[model samples]
Target: MLDASSNRINGSIPLKMGEQGNLNYLNLSNNVMSGIIPNDITLLPNLRLLDLSSNSFHGAVPVTKYSFSPLEIIDLSRNYLNGGIPVEICFIVTLTTLDLSNNSIGGQIPYCLDNLIKLTSLNLAYNNLNGQIPLSLVSLLEMNLLNNSLVAQVPDKYRYCFPAKAFVGNKKLCGNIKGLRHCDLPFFSIIMPLVPMSICIGASLFLYSKRFDQIEGPGIQLLCAFLPR
Candidate 1:
């Protein structure tokens, strides 16, 4: 258990520290560290809480190649990390709070993140993420996704659970949500259903008119032939 957070630690993380397999809690956040996060740090067997946020760390997140099974809280926000979030982070079933906000991360949010049943707080605000917000994230107690490149309709399940601020700064997002515009029905979806019904009605009308003409034609011809002669 080591807590060296909030200090102006100005250097790269020592590579040898990753050999500490028995470390339980490590917090080196709020410092000025730079360089790629060492992959060995993920090898810590008993690590529960890992916070390296508010730093100058760059490159991809450290957990892309390894699994952090025992981790519960992960705060890597306010860094310069880029690239799509690795799907392996979702493999941590014990994760509760995940913060990757205020970075340059891109790509669509992975649907596999919904597997974190214990997740309660999620923050992906101020990034370059795109695509539709996954419906599975509605179960979270707290979420912040403001200022991103997300588009399309907000899932119906999330309309009432999350406030508009959580979804603000996205220009293209729309739904039945309170703060956003209503989602427009696609042109084909609106027109397709009416087409079949219109064809049926038109066929019924044409057959009815033909039957009426057949019934009246004989009577009119007989009346004219008998009276005019």
Candidate 2:
């Protein structure tokens, strides 16, 4: 186990760090490291608790064909990491706590994340992620998804477990969740379709009135002159 967290460790992770297969429980959180997370780190055979959060690491989360079967906890939050949450990470059946909050990560949260049946805590707040909250994630004991760009209705299953604060900052998101407006039609949206029809009706009425006056003008005047005074 190697713990070097909360340091001023700068620059990219060393590519050769994966060569040490025997090592486990690597924690380098709260550092000043910047650059792409080396892919080789995922190759570690005995790695269990990997924490690289609160750094400046950029680019996609690493994926590997070979499974990290023994791995459990993974925290890469509060970084500059962008791109989708890699599907490969979901294959680790042993994961319990996963945090990727406060990053610039975009794309939909992989539905495969539901396969992590062991996941109890998940934090994905303050990202660029968009999409509905997966119904499968409702089993988690703790979750936070605040300040994302996610849209669509919040699934009914999740409303009881997670509060409205977990889903705040997403302007497009609406549902039965408290503190969010209902997803029903707005006044402007409801009236938009009627606008063109109303204009057409008004135009037709004006034209009909003008046509009637033109056709009846001389006849009405001549009839009035001929009628008993």
Best by TM-score: 1
Residue lDDT tens for model 2, 80-175: 988888889888888899899989988988899888889999999999999877888888999998999887778777788888798888887877
Q: What is the lDDT of residue 214 in candidate 2?
A: 31
Relative to the unseen true structure, what is the Cα RMSD of model 2? 13.9
Model 1: per-residue Cα lDDT over 108-148, one tens digit each: 99899998999999999999999889888999999999999
TM-score of structure candidate 1: 0.80
lDDT of 1 at 137: 92
Error of 1 at 129 (Å): 0.6
Q: Each model's TM-score, in the order given?
A: 0.80, 0.78
Tally clashes: model 2. 0
Pairs with steric clashes in candidate 2: none
Clashing residue pairs in all predictions, respectively, total 0, 0
Local distance difference test, per candidate? 0.80, 0.78
Question: Model 1: which residue pairs collide?
Answer: none
